[model samples]
Target: MSKSKFTTIGRKILMALSGFFLMFFLLQHLTINMLSVVSPDMFNDVSQFMGTNPVVQFALQPVLIFAVFFHFIMGIVLELQNRRARSIKYAYSKPGTNSSWISRNMIITGLVVLAFLGLHFYDFWVHEMTVKYGGGDMSGLINPNDLDSGYRYHEELVAKFVDPVRVIIYVISFVLLSLHLMHGFQSSFQSMGVSKGKNFIKKFGNVFAIAVPALFVFIAIYHHLQH
Candidate 1:
């Protein structure tokens, strides 16, 4: 292949690798967050452990943050390059109809997800990390860092979903996530040149695409119903 084609191929490989890494991170995050539904104390213990563990705080957390940042930057770079290659114009514009809407608008959904991430950090991370250090009330939870403050972070999360507007937003964002994953999971494999053309691989992807977001939806609904 020519140098340009080789470079394009390499960039795609990087994007796919970064994307899959982020997907794994998402699953880990969701698993931890889902603990809040089972037991507040368990979630608090785990969260506090994650927050206070020396190895995790100094090592894994930084790595996780780097993964998120790298994935985001690569995604933007790839999308921009793709748009430029297409001359920023769609011929028929039926890509959304032909494939999942999330695939067609991954960038848009990613931005929405990014916004929610900010809100999420504000709700939990900022308070947990800062309030204990006398940074003051970021989300007005009152002594958010003191595990003994009876803060009940899980309860706080459920309360947030009590607002109809926020619930709607959460559900909508999750729907976008579902769409995004439907395209993402298989596309990542394709990018890696792992096209086996096997029924099992396709079925696994389909099941994963459906199950993951369904779990998120269930979590959202469960929280919404709690209040």
Candidate 2:
């Protein structure tokens, strides 16, 4: 059964599931990235493992890619369906009277996040793939001839954030991501019918949404400052 064919409620539930998974992924990614700031060697070691390991590169990577696309596509379908359900237009627009801007423009924020992902993949994953396969080097070294040259992962990361314009784009994208997650996180719980402790859920969602993106922004700025 295709996700496109799932009942509206079923689709919402699955969408929420994927959202949760992505959230978990984001935390793990941030944790690994944080190591770059704490210890370059540790970060490089982890990156090498992730880049080389079959389970992560083959099994989890594909699933992660699928989930990203699935969540984005499902959001579009859900938004269109919601619009269709409100076929009769409300002539006068009192924007905030009904829904917050964050709620109303989830798709817009998501598009920005999606665009950032493209830039991110080109910066890291694509480069990693090229190095690991195209260049025939999985040593994570600058020069294969010298062992004391150290790993290339940390340097590559630093180089990417050296551009001021890129850092601005990254920060802006993360701000929008926070807005998207602010609504999506709580809504995911709502869609899944976990109505128990609704207030607590909303509070936790707010914190997660804000804190995660804030950390990402800090990382980007922190790296940029280092160079």
Candidate 3:
């Protein structure tokens, strides 16, 4: 009934909305990344299109970046609020052992994922932006001088992943990401008040959380093995 309670609820809903959007984005991203293994040419084509498309570059890209930041920032805010409220209300309460470890450590996993995002942006996004927008060449060719050499996207991906240390780091980060999603996916639904078929949703979330991050791990290892 308190205003702070209402605000917390509102923030949860907003966070849930942003989280849902981000989950969708992650799936889409994984699909695109998977193309590198299935067909490098196809991956390059899609990457080239995504890179050069004005609609994506000038419109959706900014929105995606905003959603990424907004989701994590709101998550941190809600976690702090929860800690404050718990201090006041559960001062003498015993810690619930029934809770899953992932649920208790969402903030930790979330922060790790946040750091991974920075590495990802630096590794791919920033470099690609420099090449596409700042390098004075719109052609996606590996060598702009020779058009027959093929696109640079797939080459860049494989080469960047060739370093074993980086691949290991990526795998570890994705494993933690899976744990984060396991708790987050169901919680997002609950936050949105979708209680019908809750059990089924939870099962699907478990599958999805594992499958997506596992595939990402596979992708990193697969590319690293190419060397």
Candidate 4:
């Protein structure tokens, strides 16, 4: 049966499952990215492995792509349904009194994140694929570490942040991402029928929401200043 035909709770469960998977990817990707700040050699070693590993390349990447697509489409569907169900706003509605801005504006923040994802793919993924498969020059770009790592991925990464405009946009994106997580992190756990109504669980989720995206913003700023 189509997931869209499922009950609201069921669709939320699907969204939660996809969200958790994406969070796993976020952790792995963030760990690798932060290495560029601490140890470029380590970053290069890990990057090469991830780039060359047949399992990661063939299996996990496709799964991640599907997860992203599924989660995004489901989110939009839910948003539309929510709007339809509440077509008439309360006459004296005080939105802030009921819900926080981040919670209320999830769809807006998600759209910003989606737009950033497109720019991000264009800046890195598309370029990487072009150089890898289309015989474009990857070696011409100057390496930040002054060492020939035989791959220009690290150099390309640093290059992207050197632009002030890109850095600002990246910072803004991460901020919105953090706001999205502020609501999503805990909500996912609640949907999965775990950690619901638990104070400690809620606290953990709140901390994760702020910390993860802050780390990403720091990475972008660090690279921009380093260059």
Model 4, TM vs. native: 0.89
- When summed lDDT is taken over every stretch of 10 residues in candidate 2, the lowest stretch is 1-10
Candidate 4, overall lDDT? 0.84
lDDT of 3 by residue, 33-139 (tens): 99999999899999999998999889989999999999898888888877887555745655576788899999999999999999999999989888878897889
If scored against the real structure, what TM-score would every candidate get? 0.79, 0.94, 0.93, 0.89
* Candidate 3: segments with Cα more than 4 A from true spot: 1-6, 86-96
TM-score rank order: 2, 3, 4, 1
Tell me which of candidates 2 and 4 scores higher on lDDT: 2
Best by TM-score: 2
Q: How many backbone clashes does candidate 2 have?
A: 0
Model 3 has an lDDT value of 0.91
Native-to-model Cα distance after best TM-score fit, residue 180 in candidate 1, in Å: 0.8
Better of 3 and 4 by TM-score: 3
lDDT for predicted candidate 2 compared with the true structure: 0.93
- List pairs with backbone clashes in candidate 4: none
Q: Please name the candidate that would achieve the greatest lDDT relative to the true structure.
A: 2
User: Relative to the true structure, how large is the alpha-carbon lDDT of every model?
Assistant: 0.72, 0.93, 0.91, 0.84
- Per-residue CA lDDT of model 2 for 1-227, tens digit only, reads 65566788899999999999999999999999999999989999998899889999899999999999999998888889899898899888899998899988999999999999999999988988898899989788888779988889999999999999999999999999999999999999999999999899889989999999999999899999997
